[model samples]
Target: MPSLLSSAIAHPARNQHLLLLQSSVAQTCLPVLRDVVQRSMERAREKTILFCLLYPPLSFLDKASRAQTDRLLVVDRTTYVPGYSDGLDFNDDVASFLRSAIMDSIQSSSLNIVIDSVDTLLSDINSVSATTRILSELLSIVRTRGGTSRLIIHVLAPCPLLPILTQTRFSPSLTHLIAHPTALLTHIASAYLTLPPPLSPPEKFWGVFIPISERHYESEKLVYGSAGEGSGLQDFVVEILVRGGADATGRRRGVERELEGWSPALGGPCEVRELDSLKSLCSEKPATEMQIVPDPTQNLPFNLNLTQEQAKSRAQVPLPYAHEGKPPVQASMPAAILYDPDSADDLDDDDPDEDLDI
Candidate 1:
């Protein structure tokens, strides 16, 4: 079976997605996720979002990051409630209020909603049913808007009330598989993404493996395009410039060599029907075509790029105010390294961040 990475790169303008994000925020995959959201917006030509529940350095916290922030809408439900605190009660009114706000925000254009940890709410008595109800209402609202809106919701608890679930529950024996984890995820998420737990010891540079729901195959089709006759060949080749590595010419150079050779017609306006036919041909006989090598001279070390220097200098760090002359204010450290496993076991099996007030 093809991987989620294949599916995601194939279809960027999907209407809905249910991603399993890790509780930590320091993971390097944030850049990849942001890239996906940006590309989705580019394809749809509308506003996009990254809704967060518990995490710091949220993309939309200040003016400096506001442009990126404007594209995101965050919901910090952690403060209102704490982790694993089963003492509180679910306020239907508050849940309804938040749901309305989210619906309004998504009404204007294509948006992506994310609920970081559903397990947080699982602690409250009857929390699963209540949250499921609210989320169902929110899904209805998004569907009514008629744009390509998606969601990357997270689940921390073992069992959920939704059908579109990302993580799977444990099984002691064949009998344990008799009961379903929950339908709440499926009811809200059109595609489910899961990740497996850490089985081996942590490596220096940890990477996550995600398996998106197989439903992707049934949900959409991939179209291929061809260069119009007599058009320049430059339009057929996509130039990729990575932040590192030696630059070379022709195909086997730079980062482009890392990607499997699959070039779609992306230069200009092409007939969709023709693109569809080309895709069918490729699928039937992928080896019949000759491999066109990508041009090199793209990769360069980040420290060598002046633009990168400026970015590194401006990165957020604790510094004294020019006038105060006192000590600098304490700044919180970056988020933890986390992974969102695309698997049934990654869902809400326990409520870890649901006790504090929102």
Candidate 2:
């Protein structure tokens, strides 16, 4: 069976991933992420672009290193979002900057974007709101782009480095896993992958949990529905809870097998269309085949289109600023400038002070 990393990279849009790694951010997390991109590039028939924007100057890549294996193009962060030391280095409007970068990349090739080490961005005591808005907007990029090739978003290794999240025993992993650690994060985030919890099972299998629910927004927060066996967490644990047998539906659940000393660099590639996801990548939809913008009113319940009668009605709806009926209120042509010659006024054009100015 393929690893969670395989499933994640293969998945199309609507996957705003949160990867929580037990290993160090620079060491294990980064290599694993790079390998995912490399594998994707190798498997893909054409070009793929990776937008990896990070912070703290913890990078080994540069402008010259843009093209890796067959054709994996990495849009170096320094080139896109200005500022070097700060991760993403975006001002208050992180969304606008990120969207601008993503839009630019969409023109290049099939896009895969990464908000690497979000821990660095959320380090400040007051960046919570900005960070949330950034995440919320990033998840919505696919919908707003209105293209068949809207970029895939990946958020890797978020919690361990954040001070608030790392304080408690379970908070770091649970913070990344369960809800309300951050309201907008859980609401917009589609998938959560924790790479080997620090406290591991004795037998040692790489545990991967990804929960996807039909998104329901109430009070502007995401609420997840029952996926397979209750919540995604509960579903992932079903293997440990009830020793195996197919359910009444007889749908075979993914049987967890022990992995022997796994390293991403050594792992072979897995096929893409293995998971049960909304975005299907059964076969690659090449750029030539993809439509630029899909119909805006695709899945909306309310009608945005107007009937002929309705269009006429809308045309009749007088705009307040349109000045529909009021005649042009011309200001009486500046009331005929009457300087009716002040009795003592001199009309001389020549400078009166010329004689005194010598």
Candidate 3:
């Protein structure tokens, strides 16, 4: 069976779009994009248009796709892209520009969009609702196209726009369900992957000492093109909304989390692996599901697991629900409930009290 990572990948119409919550590393999407684009080519025999905010990487795209990669009008260093109206900015009409680009670039067979730097886009756009709305419109457009069109939205999570979501104790689902920017994206995308930032020195201490802080960050110290704490990608927390399972509100109605390991190859894409523990489950007898929330009574000063003698003794003791002081109930002589009638239902209240002694 395919790993969770593979299953969560953006498929044709089956899984149209993906919202990737990336680490600080910008190039975390490169490996997956290579694989997805390759799959698109093999399956559809067509080119995928990449609408990248940064310059597109050369490894996957053709000369044409590369030329059109950074198609969004941008001024070199400011909010306004020069060559457009003097004071107008990309942010002023980002959604319209994307709609025009997508409509123009679409062809007979298929079209795929890879937004490489949604972090920067969100930073510049500065409105979570607007960003989400634009993506939804694009999703609707692709769905109506009646072909293998898909959108793979790859974005880093840390920016001024997101308010340092990584530093918080909040779960991704909580953030997505709240007013946070992640909500609509997670709701709309068929698959959502979180490349969580690695634990810093303090966070990794395993309760040795109270951490003064959990994560530390510095811009200049970041090492690009590597998967270490501050550099590149890591394992993914994959959440897939089954296709066609959304409700009338345009939100998937369930929640689950699956994790798998990934090792990015040098100068290439990546490989995913199921954990070592799951492989041994085949031979083992099927058991009750692994508990998600652990038993609250565990890991206390007293031992919880019983020895054989303790268990046997405990079993012998009578209890209200399971056992009584007498012999066990049997099929032939089952326990019964009886109500005695008092003297054929006599009803002489004053005289009966006086005659009770006699």
Predicted structure with the largest TM-score when compared to the true one: 3
Ranking by TM-score: 3, 2, 1
Off by over 4 Å in 2: 1-3, 10-27, 40-110, 124-126, 143-261, 268-358
Stretches off by above 4 angstroms in model 3 are 13-15, 25-27, 45-47, 59-109, 159-256, 266-358
CA lDDT, every prediction?
0.35, 0.37, 0.42
In terms of lDDT, which candidate is stronger, 1 or 2?
2
59-106: candidate 2 lDDT, tens digit per residue: 524444453533444444534433334454444334554555554454
lDDT of predicted model 2: 0.37
Cα displacement (Å) at residue 159, model 2? 2.6
Rank the candidate models, highest lDDT first: 3, 2, 1
Per-residue lDDT, model 1, residue 11, is 43
Residue 270 in candidate 2, Cα distance off native in Å:
11
Better of 2 and 3 by TM-score: 3
In model 3, state the lDDT of residue 235. Answer: 31
Please give the clash total of every predicted structure, in order. Answer: 40, 1, 2
Candidate 3 lDDT by residue in tens digits, 56-165: 45555566644543332222223333455374354444455556655655554555555555666665567766766666565565555545556556555444434433
Whole-model lDDT, candidate 3? Answer: 0.42
Q: What's the TM-score of every candidate structure?
A: 0.34, 0.35, 0.43
